[model samples]
Structures are given as structure tokens and as C-alpha cells.
Target: MPQTVKLRPYRLADEPAAVGLWQRSWQLAYPQIDFSQRLEWFREHWSGLQLDSRIVVAECETVPDHLAGFVAVSPRTGYLDQIVVAPEMQHRGIGKALIDAAKHLGREGLYLHVNKDNSRAIAFYRKSGFTIAGEDINRRSGAPVYMMTWRPAADLPPEP
Candidate 1:
């Protein structure tokens, strides 16, 4: 049987692994960007954010020593700041579990911005029930991003 995966709050000890995951995932998803700049951005934005804002790490029962994935949520907006699974461990339900946990925390809905050119993420978010709410130019990356949102089950469908 497949091992169970546990989701728990992120600790300061997990920073290195989390940063490594962020670096690798970003490199795979946005290869054209300058590496140093991307790292700097992550260091500045992610590092400075309120840690208790809602960050969780996933670990498999069989190999509890390593983190398999992580999700970070903003307290105010309930927005998903980041959700990344190890490259070798994608599509094994890690992302879904993390998302479900976020929803369970009373996050009525969630939203995230994805680069317009990142078709893979766009597809994944769509499959996960997010719909494009609008598009806007991202000054930092010089790329257009699709602002996607998942409304509370009782809310009306987002107008296209």
C-alpha cells in the first residue's frame, strides 16, 4: 500500500528544503528568467512574509525525513502564495491534499496568479476548480498573469 502523507505546519527548520523546492520548481517552470534575480525575489518576498500566515509541509509516512510538498496561504486573502511538489513527485495527490487542508482551515476560497505563458499550471489550476478571473501585467516578471480564483461553493460562477 502507498504510504500515508501527513500535512503539518511549516517550521523554521524546513526553510532550507522549502527554499530548495522553490528554486527547483521555478527553474523548471520559468527557465528563461535570470536565475539570480529569481532567487533574490524569492529571498525577499517569501523570506520576509509572515511565517504564521499559513504554511504547511507534506511528509510521507514511509520516508518521514523529507518534505514532499508545501503550500503557503495568505491569512488576509486566503490566497495561495505558493504550492509546490518535488519535481520527481508530482501528480501523486500531494498538491490536492495541501489544497484541501487550506480549504479546511476556513479559507472560503483561494486565488493565485500564474504567468499567462505557463500553460501547464494554467491547466492544473483549471482542473483543480479555479477559473480565470482576469489578466494583468506583472511588473516584476514582465509577463502577463492570469488571476485565477476558486469561489466558495455557494458563490456564483466567475463571469468570464
Candidate 2:
């Protein structure tokens, strides 16, 4: 991990790095699925999705152009649309930083869906204070996913 990882609002120039980061992370997480086929779809919808949500990126101070990870969160409903960390950057607190940023933006709660088969992400979310809220099928991919949610109070210190 670098000495500093800065979180900042999404910028237009960050799109390419963001897309590449998402592609690599998703590919590694879902090896059975060929994300290349849907890369264009992600590109086309990237702008619109971030426009409607709070998108934050984690950048290492040493490597300015290298985007370690990012998270897309809806402030209104606290829906965590997406969070991806570069394969090389996993387990280094980038994802947690992104989640913390989402909490700051959406005090109501933070929620997201993870593929049922993604045990790694499930465990990570569990460690981050999220619980399985429910299950649902992803409309586009028709894959089963577990809806996970985390509330601000979940991590509050016990009343003394």
C-alpha cells in the first residue's frame, strides 16, 4: 500500500482508467463470464450512471495515473451500484475507503448486490458491516445475487 490514497469525485478524464479497472476486476471475479462482450455496454452507460450517483475513485499518491479502485453510490437511496478494485490492489483498504466515502454521502444506509457465487466479495462485505438483506436475480444477466446492506448504526459504538 502507498503512504497515501486519495479519494476524489469522478472526473471525465477518469473514465478510461475507471472502465479499465472495472473490466479487470470483474474479469478476475467472474472468470466464467466474458466481460469483454459487455464492455461497450458499460462504456455507454458509465456516464449516465455516475451522473445520477456519487462516484468516488481511490488514487495512489505515488502513481497518479493508476486508479486503485472506485465505488458508485446513490446518495438518495444509498444504493451502492458498483465497487471494483484493481486485482493488484485488493486487500489494501481501497474498497473500505470507497465504502466509507459512500457512508459519508448517504447516511440512510449503504446497499449493494453481489453474485451468489462471489464468496470473496461476500466475506469482504460481511467484514465491512454488511448483512444479507435478500436475494434477487440480476435482470440483465439472469444471475442470482445476494442483496447486502449496511447501516450506520450497525457499526456504532455500544452505548456506555
| Count of residue pairs whose backbone atoms collide, per candidate | 0, 0
RMSD to native for every prediction? 4.7, 3.3
Question: What TM-score does model 2 achieve against the real structure?
Answer: 0.91
The Cα RMSD of model 1 versus the native structure comes to 4.7
Candidate 2 global CA lDDT score: 0.85
Off by over 4 Å in 2: 154-160
How do the predictions measure up, each by TM-score? Answer: 0.86, 0.91
Query: Roughly what TM-score does model 1 have, to 2 decimal places?
Result: 0.86
Query: How well does model 1 score by local distance difference test?
Result: 0.78
Compared with the true structure, what per-residue lDDT tens digits does model 1 show for residues 58-80? Answer: 87777865788888887677778
